[model samples]
Each structure stands twice: as C-alpha cells, then as structure tokens.
Target chain A: MEMTGLFFYLVSVLIAGGIYAVLCLALNVQWGMGGLFNAGIAGFFAVGAYASAIVTTAASDKHLGGFGLPIPLGLAAAMIVAGVTGWVVAKICVRLKSDYLAMASVGIAEILRLVIVNESWLTNGSLGISGVPRPFADLVQGRSADLVYLAVVWFCVLLVYILCQRLYVSPWGRTLRAIRDNEDSARAAGKDVDWFRLQTFVIGCALMGLAGGLSAHYFKFLSPSATEPLLVTFLVWVMLMAGGSGNNRGAIVGALAIWFIWSATEIFTSRLPPEWITRSSYIRMLLVGLLLQFVLQKFRSGLMPEKSPKIRSD
Target chain B: MIDFINLYLVPGLAIGSVYALGAVGISMIFGILRFAHFAHGDLMTIGGYGVLTAVWFIPVNPLLLLPFGIALAIVSALLVDQFFYKPLRKLPTIYTVIASFGVALIFRSVAQLFWSSGNQVFTSGVRMPMVLFDTFRISELHMQVIILTVIIAIALHFFLTRSKLGRAMRAVSDEPELAAVAGLDTERVVRWTWVIGASLAATAGVFAGMDTSMHPNLGWNLLLAMFAAAVLGGIGKPMGAIAGGFIIGIAEETVTYTWFSDEAFISPSYKSAVAFFIMVALLLFRPQGLFKGRLL
Candidate 1:
C-alpha cells in the first residue's frame, strides 16, 4: 500500500478503535461500576446508529428521515433514543437477578437487531440505508475527511473519559460501588438500588449510542449487518473484560490494542498462501476465544484494576 | 380451522419435542452448575456429527442408530466434562461461562476445520413416513422424536422422583452445601447430572439431525430457542424447560400460519429472533418463569 493509503487505513482503524473504546467505557460503567451484566450493548448501539442515520439523511418518498438536522443534533437525538431504550430495558430487567438479567438483555438485543432487519418499511430492511453525510464534511476535503473525523471522535472520547473520571471519584461513584458490592446492604442503608442501576445503565447505553452514531456518520452507512451479535456484542465484551472492566483508561487501551491486532491480522492474512489464509480466519477466532478464556483465568482483575478513590477522614 | 390445526399443530408438537429434549439438558446443567454453558449447543452438534459418523461406518438401520448415537453422545459429554468442566470446577461461575464460550468456539473451529462448513445429510433406507389414520400423516423422523422424548421424560421423572441417586441429585441442586454436610456425595451427583443432561442433549441433536439437515452451526443456531425455553420454564426446573421448549416451538410454527406472507418477507432467518422475543417478554413479565416460584 502507498504511504498515504496506509496512513488513511491506520487513521481509520484508530478512529474505529476510539469509537469502540467509547463503547467499552460505557459498558464498564454498567458492568464494572454498577455490576449490571448487560449483554445487549449492541442493541442500543444499533439503535443510535439508525436513529442518527434516519434523522439526518434526507427524507424521500421511499423512506423517512428527520428534516436534515445538523450532525450534532442528530447525534443528540441518537443518544436520547438509546438512553430511553436502555432505561426501559433496565426498568423491566434490573428487577431480576444477575443471570436472568443477562439473558433478558441479550434477548432484547437480538430482538432489536431483528426489528432493524425485518422492519423494512421503517429501517429500509436488510437493503440498508446509505448516503449519510459526515459531520463537517463540507469543510474537510477528500482525503482529509478521515483525519478530521478521527479528530472529532477522539475529541468526544476525551470529553467522555474526563466526565467518567470525575464520576468515578464522586459520591455517586461511592454509592455505585456500594450497590455493586452488596445491593441488599445498599438498599438497607437507604440507597435506591434500582434507580441507581437504572441511571448507570441508561447513561452507559447513551454513551454507547453516541459512539454508534459517531461511527455511522464516519462510515456514512447503516446496515443490520453492522450489529451482528458476534461481531458487535461479544467483541465489545472481549474488549471490556480484556481491558480491566472497572478502569476507564484500561477500556480505551484495550480497545485500541484489540483493534490494532484485529486489523493487522486481517491485513496480514491476505498476503499468505490461499489455503493458509483461509485457515487463518478460523485460527484468529479461536485465538480470540482462547485469549478471553486465558485472561479470565489468569488476570480476573483485568489488565488495569481501577484504583480505589482515596479517603481522608475529616 | 380444524384442518389447519391438524396440519400444523400436530407437526408442531413433534418438532417441539425435539426442542424440549435439548432445553431439558440446558436447564439441568444451569441448575447444577450455575452458569450458562455455551458449549452445550456445540456438544449437541458433536452428537449429531457422532451419529452421522457412526451411520457412515456401520450402514445400520436408523432405529438401531438411536442407541448407538445416545451412547456416543454420552461418551462425548463425559469427555467434554473431563477435559473442560473438571478443571474449571474451582473457578467462579462467570469464569466457567466464559470458558464454555471458548470451548464452544474451539469446537466450532474444529468442526469447520475437520468437516468443512457445508451441510451434510445422512439418509438411510428407512424413508417411510408414519401415518396416523388416513387423514393425518407424519414423518418417521417425527415419530421417532415423539417416542424418544416421551421415553426420556418418563425415565428422567422416575429417576428424579423414585430413585436414591436422583433424590441425592435433587438435594444437591436445592442446597449444595447442605447436601454436602448431609453426607450426600455432591461431586457424584454433579457428574451424573452432566451425564444425563449431555446424553439427552445429544439425543435431541441426533433426532433433529434426522428431521432436518445437519450442519456445523445447527446446534448454535438452535441455542437461542433452547435458552428461551429453559428460561421460560424456570431455569432449574427440567420439566419446566421441556414445557417451555414445546411452547416456544409450537408458537413459532403457529406464527407462520397467522402471518405466512409477512413472515416470508421477514425471512425465517429471523426465526431465532422469535425465540429471543419470547424470552425477553417472559423476562419482563415473569422472570421466575411459569412453573418456578421465585428466582434462585
């Protein structure tokens, strides 16, 4: 590949990595801080992507889109949709115990994907919706669009990271940890456990949705295939678990590392012998699975355990 | 309406029986182990492949293959338990769950590596369709599924309710620590539970293979439905899982009749989504499931 082409690929991959990192951070807030085992992050992510795509794209007789709102407004709408969906799912499922809640969330995610796939009248069905304009595309020309988009995504990621770090050290974070450690005790101590969980889940899902919206605009396409369970959901779980689920910084680091490995492997696989290349895809999947299992076995605390906030008695 | 019921409902029940068998195994394992064993689906796939392999070599009658297939499935289950589950016994439930997911991915890769991803059909000379009177007709495969399901259900019911080992297994499920303190061999019970559950799952796979074409992804594809059934029936309750499986199967099949054309547009590809929808609805409205009193 040419230098510029390689540069574009690398930057694009980094942008994708940033988007996924945002998602991992969102999941960390839900699973690590709040102890909610949400397996349906992809559903909310997809909802955000579709919400933004529909809102910003020009409406035609064939399909409906919001009246050509600006990208930021569309993204805001996406977050709202995703957050509300998360809240509804949380209200229904958080009342259940751990395993059941996981199952329920996964089920909902699958259903959401199906609806996106089957509701052709609404989502354009499996044919997918395209021609989405990138944010600030008018200002950035041609090859520079990729770099500009990367900058935009990184900006959002940094903002979210700082906000999350603040939350992690606040009183709310203390209450979240208390609920995670012992929900019954938290409730007994006058903490509204369900409300806190719901809050965390919705906020996390909203962030995930915003990440999705960002990606959708960057890619300039929306499809049900983008939200497959194995690719989106399990991949995010792998990132979260691998990165140290409780640590926001770790989540971002893990996302970048995994995406780099994944991209590098994909690029390398094609250059090898055809049969070897064919075999390598399966090997790659197996390696990922084994890596996850190994990580869980050895470093159950993940790569970076979140530091406990220091306490000073007055 | 009566004719439609006869045409659809009876066949639905037969298909549902297959799902029930698989669901029972899933529920039993969850009850005992307290984790969603993702490998359970792949184990079923292994059983189907096992039966196919045996039939390929032996040229035996399909009827005879049942016992052989069940035996092979039992052995496969035992091997998986020994190699995978045994080492992870000391780990947390989530660790085991993730390990099972890995094991499942490994099994899938192995299947892809060895068998190729193409679908395989194992046909025997026994292609006769069973007829229920002149008007009602069913496949021999469907008949086998019904008979096997009933036999397994009766046998398991007897074993759980009337046998000492079965009672011990129940004790362990109810309270593992208490059962251990009460001098019940908890390890032994867990082993037997795996044996029974694995064997039943394999049997379901073999029967399902006979009815439909066997493929690498068949069991994994059926997982959502199996999970829906298990959860709908109450996670730990074997009978509930069975009933939940049947309910899901029949409901999905019946939905085809109501929305046949629209369903066609939706593509039976979304069939898994139907099961997931049912599971989510059940979770939202009745998380404890139909038969269970409360969450464990």
Candidate 2:
C-alpha cells in the first residue's frame, strides 16, 4: 500500500476506534460504575446521530434538519435529546428491578428504530438523512480532513475518559457504587438511589449521544440500517466484557481490540472463495459465540479486571 | 363487516394461537429458570427449520411433519439447557441473560448458514379456505392453527394442574429449594420443563411457518411478541399466557387496521412497535398482568 493510503487507512481505523472508545466509556459508566445496564446502546447512538445530523444539515422540504446550526450546538442538542430519552426510560424502568430495566431498554431501542424507519417527516424514512457537516471541513480537504476528524474524535474520547475517571473517583462516584451494591443500605445512608441512578443514566446516555454525533459527522451519513440492535448493542457489550468494565482505560483497549477483531474478520470473510461465502458468515458467528464463551469461562473478569476499590480514609 | 371479520378477527385468532404457544413456552421457562430466555426465539427458528427438514422427506402432509419437528426441537432444547443454563444455574441472573444472547446469535447464524435468507414454504396437496356460516372464511391452515392451539393449550392446562409430573414442575417453579427439601426431584422437574416448553415452541414455529413462510429470522421477529404475551398474562401462568396471546394477536391485527384520522398513521412497520408499546404500557400500569403470575 502507498504511504499516504496507509496513513489514511490507519487514521480511519483510529477515528472509528476513537468513536467506539467513547461508546465503551459511556457503557463503562453505565454498567461498570453505576451498575445500570443499557441494552439499547444502538438506540441511544442513533438518537444522537440523528439529533446532530438534523440540527447541522441544511434544510430540506421533505424532512427536518433544515436549521443548518453549528456542529457544537448540534452536538449539544444531540446530548440533550439522548439524555432526555434516557431520563424518561430511567424514570419508567430504573425504579423497579434491574432486569425490567434491561428488557425495557431493549424495547425502547426497537421503538426508536421503528420510528426512524416509519416516520418519514422526521427521519426521511428508509433513505435516511445525508450531508452531515464535519468540523473544519472548509479549511482542509481529503486526507488532511480525515486526520483532523481523527484528532477531533480522539480529543472527544480523551475528554470523556478524563471526565469519567474524575467522576468515578469522587465521593459522588462512591455513592453511586454504593447505591448499586445495595440500594437498601444506600437508602439507609440517606442516598436517593432513584435520583442518582437517573442522573448517572442521563450522563451515560449523553456520552453515548456524543459518540453517535461524532460518528455521524465523521461518516457524513445517518441511517436506520447502520444501527442494528445485535450489531450495536451486543457487540458493544462483548467489547466491554472482553476489555473489562469499570475502568476507562481498559474500556478503550477493549473497544479497539474488538473493533480490530471485527474488522479483521470482515476483511477475511470478504476474501474467502465464492463457494464458501454463505458458510463463512455463519462460521464467523460461531467463532464469535465460541470466543465469547471462552472469554466468559477463562477470563470472566476480562483482560483488565476491575481494580480493587481504593481505601478511603474519610 | 366481511372485511373486518376476515382481516381482523380470523387473522387475530390465527396469530394469537401462535403467540399463545410461544408465550406458554416463555412463561414456563421463566417460571422454572427465573431469567428471560432470550434464546427462545431462536429455538422457534430451529423448530421451523426442523419442520422444513421433516417436510422434505415426508411430503405426505405438513401436520405429519409436526411430530418430527417437535422431536428435533425437544433434543435441541435439552442440549441447550444442559450446555448453557446448567452451568450458569447458580450464578447471577444477568449471566444467563448475556449467555442466552450469545446462544441466540449462534442459533440464528447456524439457521442462516443452512437455509440462507429467502422464505421457505410447505407444499400440500390443496389448501382450501374453510367458510363458516355465510361471509366468514378462514384457511385450512388457519383453522388447523386455531384447533391445534386450543388442543395444546387445553392439554397443557390439564397437565400442569392435574398430572403428577405437572404438579412437580409447578412445585419446582414455586420454590426449588423447598421442593427439593420436600423430596421432589428437582432435576426431573427441570428436565420436564425443558421438554414441555421446547415441544410447545417447536409446534408454534411449525404452524407459524405453515401459515406464512419459514425464514431464519422469523422467530426472532416473533420473540418480542412472545415476551409481550407471556409478560402480559403474567409470567409463569400457562392459561394467562394463552389469554395474553389472544389479546396481543387481536390487538396487533386491530392496530394494523386502525389509524389516526384519514391517512395510514401507524403504518405496517409499527406492528412490533405496537406490541412493544403494549408490553411497556403493561409493565408501567400492570406489571403483574391480567392473571397475576409471579412478577420478578
């Protein structure tokens, strides 16, 4: 491969990996630290992507997204939209048992997908919205633009990672974990478990929304097809599990590793002889299942097991 | 009126029967195992494909293939339980949920690998729509669906309420530890639960495939409906599941027809959304459902 080609290819992978890193971090915050399970990761991701795309893209007669707002404001609107959805879902499902929350989340994700598919005026139906603007697109073109996008996405990932790292170490973080560990005891300590869970859920969803917005802007496209529940929800979960949750750095490693494995498998599958094509995809699924089972049994704690809780002298 | 009867009522009954069979399986497993068996949908797929295999050999009749498909599905259900659920029985509920998700992917992949994507239909000598009274018509397969579901649901009701093994299964679902202490063979109960639930699932899949065409993802689409029906009637109650099934079935058909104002507001794609909305509304207002089975 040419040097420039290689650079672009590598930068593209990094850009994709960085967006996933943000998603993984959001999941870590929800599942790892807050003990909130959001099975509808794709739904939240789609919400943010569409939200940003709608706000930033030029106005069309058929559908929404005519505002042509700035990218930052678009991203902020994405966060608010995703956060509010999370808040409503949390209010409905979080107060009850945890399992209900998981099932409800799945329902919510499917509902969102249905809306995107059926609601023509909002999402342009199946065709989806296009021409999502990128930051600094005017200044740089081609490969340079990609590099800039990579830097921007990674910067966002790093920003979120640092924010999560700081939040999890604070007293508020300790309280969230406490609520997760034992709601009764947390309540005994005067912690409002419901309120804390709601806040953490919104924060996690906002991060996920931000990841989606960045991903949409980078790709310059948004569609219902890209957000399959199994591909988005289950894959993110397996990544989190393999990378180990709770810790932000480990989550990033997990995201990159799984994303690479997925991409590698796709490339490998594409190159297979014509005869073996149908079986190859199935084999891929089998391999993923086997890989997950092996990972679960052998390294249940994941590659980077969560660090032992730090002693607090306070 | 004819259109409403044919379009809404008859189809509702047919679809409701399928959902009833599926919901019964889901409720039984949930009661006995105490986790959402996300793999149940894929199990239905296996049963559907299993029927396809049976029909290939004995094209004499599709109903004749039912027993064969049920047999294959029973073995698979046993194997899945022995392999996955047995190991994680004592662990946290979440492990089983995630593990089931993995298993679901595996089943779907295998089905897709074998059958690929297009729909597969069963060939019979002649399909005649049975007309009841004057203007009411239902297909033979649909009639068979309604009759078969009623028979199975009744048999299941009797088996769960009257039979010794059925009582043992209920006992185990109620309290495994206590049942064991009381000298009920817990292993036997678990095995029977798997057999019964899986058999019902296979039957449902076979008929659903008969009504429509069989595909790898057919059961996956129906999974949420089964969940809604199962949870709607209250989990663990077979009778309630049947009731929930019919309710969901009629509601799905009715919603398809009923739209806001003049235009088709709901659209065809919102069918699952409607089912999900019902499930959510139930969860919010009446989590215990109509019959009030155990709520986890």
Candidate 3:
C-alpha cells in the first residue's frame, strides 16, 4: 500500500510538472525568443483557468456557467480568451523597456485579481468554481483516472515542445532573435519590431492559458488561490530559467526537476514537529528563492543551454 | 464637504504620503541602478516588521521606534544588492530584475517565518479622531503622517540641490557614463541611494502599518500604487514622484467618494484599479512621464 501511494504521488507530480513544462515553453517564446518580459503569467493563467472552468462545469446558480461544454472546447476557449487579454496588454505595454513592462504587467495581474474577487456574479467571488470536469472521466475509474490525466498532460507538453522547437529554428524565430538581440538594427533592417513582439506575447500567453486549463481539469476545481503569482508566475519562471530559457528540451527537464524539488520538499516539511509545521512552508519558500539565486549565479545559461542552428554561408 | 474632507481626503493624503516615500526610493533606484527593484515592496514589509519588533521589546509607540525599522530595511537592501545584484551588474539589467523577484520571495518568506502570516497591530485599540471646529474630524496619525512627509520632501529637495553627494547622485542617474567620466565616485552614490531609498521605504512601511494593521503583504499590496506614483512623477525624478504619489493618493480616495448620488461613483474595492488606470494612460500617452525624467 505504501508503495502504491508513492507511485500515485509520483504520478501527481508528473502531472503538475507537465503543466509547468507547458507554461515554461510559453514563457520561453516571449522572454527567450522575443525578449519580452511578461511578469503577469498568473493573470493570463487565471483567465484561462476560470474561462475553462466556467465553460465546462455543469449548470449552477453559484457562478455564471451553464454551458457544460466539451473539455477540449473549454481548453480552446481558454487559450483564445487569454490570447485576447495578451493582445490588449501588449498593445499598451509592449513598447516599454523590460523593467517598465514588468511593473505594468504586475499591475494588470493585480487588477485581474480584484476583478475575480469583487465580481461575484461572474466568478462566484472567493468561493471559486467546483466540479470542473476532467477529460475522459467516464472512461476511467479511481486510480486509473489520474494516470489518464497524466498521459493527457504529458501529451500536451510534448505537443508544445515540438511546436517551440520548430519555431526556434524557423526564419520567423530568427527575426524575433534579431529584434531581441538588437532592436534598432532589426528596425533598421525594416522589420516591424512592435508587431512581432505583440504576436509573440499573444502566443506565449495562449500557451499559458492552455496550461492553466489543464490544471483546472486535472484538479477538477478552480479557485483564485490556485492561481497565485508565487505558484503560477514565479515558479514557472524559475523552471524556465533553470531549464535553459532558449531550449525547449531544457524547459521540460527544468519543469520536471524543479517540480520534483518543490513537491518533495513538502514531504519533509510536513514531517517536522507540530510547532515547526506552520513555519516549514515559509522555509521551503526561502529555499526555493535561494535555489533561484544559485541557479542564476552559477548556471547562468541553465542546465540545457541553447544551441543556435548554423546556416550554410555557401 | 466636511464629511468628504474628513473621511476620504485625510485618509487619502496619509496613504499618499506613504506612497510618496516608497516611490521616491523606487524612482531613485530605477534612475541610478537601471533596473526595477522588484523586491522594493518587501523592503517596506521589512520596515514595518522592524518597527513592530522594536515595539514588542520596548512597548512604546511604533512611531518612536521608526529608526529601528529604517535601519533594518537599509541593511536588507544593502545586503541584497551586495549579494544578488552586485554579481549580476555586468550582465543585462533584466537579470537583476529577475533576481529581485526572487529576493522579493525570500524577503516575504523571511517575514512569514519571523512573524506569522496573521495580521498584527502596533497598538490594539483604535484612537479616537481629533475633532476640529466641531465639524472637521481627523486622526492624529493622519496629521502626523502629512506633516512628516512635508518635512521629508523639503529635506530631500535640499539634499538634491545643495549637497554634493545628492548632485552627484542626480548626475549618475541622468547620465551614468558622463558621471563616471567626470570622476564621480559611482559606488559611493550607489550606497547612498540604498541608504536614502531604504530609509524612506522603512518610514513609509511603519506609517502604513500605523494607519492600518501590519501584515506580511502590507507593502506588496501597495506596490503598484507606489509604482504608479513613481512613473506618474517621472521615472527618475524624485520630486515628480512625490507629486505623482499625492495625485494618485488623492484620486484613489476621492474616486470612491459618493459626490453626485447616494452611492459611490466607483466601488471602493476598485480603488486600487484607479492608480493602474492612471499608470496605463500615462504610459500610453506620456511615456516620458509628467516630469520628463527619463525617456525609458
């Protein structure tokens, strides 16, 4: 029984790790490829999560959802909604330098939090939406259900990885790199820098929305707490930075490794004496923060550094 | 009118003063360091908790123990810069910004570890408002906050214009290469920037705590408003940041005031959004900000 419990715990970690893998890939597109600093990953993630939850949940008076749409459609809607939000934000903030953009995005995320809390008619205020349906729930039962979700999550991660890898070597990707590495030169070369940035930001946010939707379905519940910046935004950033920002493979590796550390630390923290239990979580957080610093300082290029594709001069 | 002035206006100015203090630091750091210090809000948190810790030991008014908070905040800022930021100085500014994000988490978690996540106040019971002219009512704290801010503003003006270090600081902020070429001590300016910024942030944190209750997120929650002030005043212009802070503070307070009808014009919950909107609008139309500080 203990062995089986450990197996199930590992499965759950993989599922969350897969979701973070997707999020890291999305962020890589913006920050790594396009050099856009999007600090409001949690905001877009919440938009997708709530959008999917509101769409797929069975008819209920508690929130503004009665559509009970198919889970796939809900996911699609999540991406689209989050993409639209990204577009709006990008239109306003894409021009700002890195730090200014970061502050603006943080503000946008805070406003979104306020909307989620105060607009009870739509989001059920702080109560959050429950009974969010999982994909293939009817076909699977008990423990198998989690396994199927794990498979689904990894499949999404694989799909996103392939897409990112393909984009990395493409001419469009080269243009984005040109803009990111040297914006004035890119503009001098007649490339529309702002438009490309907007597109990259939208695509990245859409992927984040997809990740958020997957988590909502996996947990079978959606709430504001699950979408906090520390978990959604900061954690994914750490994963991407640790994994190697420009490499898709590194994103997946970083996600799984960091997710493991994040989860396993909890096991030890939970075993502490009763008095220390409450403070353990904070200690864990401090460790994670320190880990980020170590990774940044020691492993500047991350575990899997990006290898740019060579073009023939002939 | 009396109700409006007493209820909304005074509170707005008081909070605005806090925002100004924090924004001044943010603006200076952004100007001199060339990166948005994401951990700034947490510095304020450290300040509040610093004062609270002193209060616990001395059992005195939190205001009397304000210097302790300032010292604590200054130490944290300098330490973070030394360890995290200094290492990344040669790298891109984005690296520093990202490091600051991690620093923010570290600071917040430390606060949680030292002081439980739950809310705690310096003084448990509320003080009665001071009534003036039988019609006007104001908290003594509010009066003190406003007066203190005014005094700090004047002192800051002199420090900027009169003192050699202050002028050197401004020179570095405006043109770092030029300042360096002029044989100015950049490292000394950087140290002074942290001292002034961290000290003001501590004062703001304590004042904010005194106004409300001290919590782990006391500064984090007010962070954007302070940013709005910094940006509105102009990114690197300290005086402009001060004016921007008061403007945002007053607007945030008065917007919710029910002037036209029996209900609030805007919901009180959306008061935070007011600063955000102002910031977005300014960023869109006037990216140089009101004071034309720095184009970036």
Among all candidates shown, the one with the greatest DockQ: 3
List lDDT for all candidates, in order.
0.79, 0.84, 0.91
Better candidate by TM-score, 2 or 3: 3
Among these predicted structures, which one has the highest lDDT?
Answer: 3
Residue B6 of model 2 has an lDDT of 90
> Is 1 or 2 the stronger prediction by DockQ?
2
Q: How do the residues B1-296 of candidate 3 rate in per-residue lDDT, one tens digit apiece? A: 88899989999999999999999999999999998888888899999999999999999878889999999999999999999999999987998999998998999999999999999999988699999989979999999999999999999999999999999999999999999999999999999999999999999999998988889888888899998999999988999999999999999999999978999999999999999999999989998889997977
In the order shown, the candidates' DockQ scores are: 0.52, 0.61, 0.89
lDDT tens per residue, model 1, A110-191: 7788788788877898878887879788897998888998999999999889978888889998899999887889999999
Q: Write the per-residue lDDT of candidate 2 for residues B98-191, one digit (tens) a residue.
A: 7787788888888888887678888744677878887778887888899988998889889988999999888887787899999998888888
Give the candidate order by descending TM-score: 3, 2, 1
Error of 3 at B5 (Å): 0.4
Tens-place lDDT per residue, model 1, B222-252, is 7778888888898778888888888988877
lDDT tens digits, residue span A7-75, model 2? 787788889989889899999989888888787899999999999999999998667855899999989
